[model samples]
Target: MIDYTKWDEYYDGGFADEEPINNFNEEYDERSELEKLEYGGQKTNVTAKQIMQETGTTAISEKFLYRNGVVIILLDYSKGIFDKWKNGRILHCLGDRTYTTQQNTNGLSIIDRTLFNADSIDKIIVRAFWKDETKKYRLVNGLLVLSKEKPYTIEENGKYRWVFPLSLMSKYNFQMPEKYSYFLDIKSVKEAALINADKEDGVRLTTLNKLARFSSSKNDIHYKRTPQKKIKYTSVQEKIERSSKIAENALILADFKCEINNDHFTFIRKNQNVPYTEAHHLVPLAYSDLFNYSLDVEENIISLCSTCHNQIHYGKDSESLIKKLYANRKELLKEAGIVLSEQELLEMYNNS
Candidate 1:
């Protein structure tokens, strides 16, 4: 069993490092590589019931094992599951068995009750894994989001299943440890998921203030460069998640002063002893899909004092403040693959 307390050790960087075993003896084994990885070399297929037993969970669901505050789901990459809904969002479907009637209420009810009740599971951590070309089950990606929508039944080919739509709050990559087991320890897995989520600024901003200081000292803010685009997910409300790191970097680059006017003084933060400034996306993340590139870059972020921040958001003269910020960042935005005419930009804010 892997010691998930030392979860940092389990991450093997990414799947790119693993090489496919093309010369492996396939004639001896009729099972595909994916099946082998999923079953951990077992001749017979492993059932979710078996996995639940191994994990020591009493959860009724065969698809997901819910314990504590986390939701662990096993995804099959070969099937190309996770249906893509309109606006580029992905939908994860519950098992094929339908459970609408009271007598049939089993696993789905447990999931619905746990997810909707606020006091129950506040954190929904998705530990996503996939079978790689190396015939190994690699922990590829993860997602952290709140469940706002209820599961509804969908029918196809005379068969019915529950479909749950999740908005992408945060998406992250995972790395496996050198020594690992196919059967995950629920306690350890939960700890590891939380740790990984924190690293990506996906779960919570617990380390945002600490990271801001470190980034300010180590990173050069003058050199304008675009960061790797984050994977976009569809949500019912069409909201986009922003990176806390990018916003922190923007604040650091601005020397923790208001961009509207540096002379506008604010109280120093007790923890960091720096002027407390908030980060704002000049081009809102909601309209990210309209552009070809990502809108969550540092150049698009602006630092502002709390008073000025509120003024820009709530004050009547927001247009003046917007104009000033746009003029200053027009060139920088162009460099970062975000090009918008001043008039076009104003219309966005005005419509909002």
Candidate 2:
């Protein structure tokens, strides 16, 4: 019979370790030790199979951080499970925390606007972890969807996460499994204010409209509806907000005057120094698909007062207004390589 202790020592030193080290030129022990320290003493250093065998648990709690700020809620799920779910649709949210990563139910004031700007969309890499399991990562472009529910009245109360409603999930081609029914309903103060003043009258409309522009999302379109039985409407496309550069440039180009009738705004915005005017994409940004070039450029942007802008889209003679504007910009648009005729542009707007 072979001597077992001498055989074990020979196997460990010569065969078990030497073969892989010589073949791959890898320093597994050193790399693992470094990763162990980098991941904050987490158990990701162990293999997933080993972890599963030891703990008898398949699911893990994952936290996502962005620029060192917490942006994901603590959710329990396996990597394979989340990957399968994400195949349908991936959603993310900004967590209720200060920049210091401490929980703050009050608001997102402590959040860094530099990295997590509330006004614009940001692409973030989500780092997810499950108890002692190897950490999983995903890169997704996500936006903040404000909760419709009141924070104070809710049982948990105060700060909460953004939710993907079933309606929206279907729109995005994602379906939540029957077993998981959790949805977020938390909103920030700014979002709440905008929702509350959705249908403002007169002076309030100016502020509402201004706030609406600042708070609009480039990826999604939202609309308010009044109950009616006669009309059946289907949502076709998401609204894309004009770039800040395009809007501001248009305003400056028009010298703050209404492009249609050359009239100044009726009322000045409450805290703003400039007269209020809405930015209108001449070719309608919604139909941007038809053109090879971007519709969000300065030449395609026009400034109009609230009344004129609304009339162009909803009034009985909106077609005539669109034609007139097209006529005015045809040459300039031609110069910028946007060669759509007046009727072609009008049809594009109507279709959208």
The candidate that wins on lDDT is: 1
lDDT of 1 at 245: 65
> After superposition, which runs of candidate 1 have C-alpha atoms over 4 Å from their true positions?
1-215, 218-223, 226-228, 232-242
- Residue 232 CA displacement from its true place in model 2, Å: 34
* 1-352: candidate 1 lDDT, tens digit per residue: 3232221232332123334334222421322322211111101123445444544545545345666555545545445444332222223445435554523335645555443332222354444333322233444233423234555657645645566554323223332321233332222224444344334432213445444453355256553665336555475122223366667777888888899999998887757767888778787655565566777788998988878878876799888999999999988887887766665566666555
Estimate the TM-score of every prediction. Answer: 0.38, 0.33
Model 2 misplacement above 4 A: 1-242
**Candidate 2 lDDT over residue span 1-352, tens digit each:** 2222232232122223322222111322222322111111101223333333433433222233334323332233443232111111222333333232223233443232222332222332122222213243111112222212212211134433322210001011111221221111112124334333232213233433554333223333211111112222243111122255446556666766788888645566565556778777786544433445555566777878888888976787888878888888877775565555454666555543
lDDT computed for candidate 1: 0.52
Note the Cα lDDT for every prediction shown: 0.52, 0.39
Give me candidate 1's TM-score against the actual structure: 0.38
| Cα distance off (Å), candidate 2, residue 4 | 81
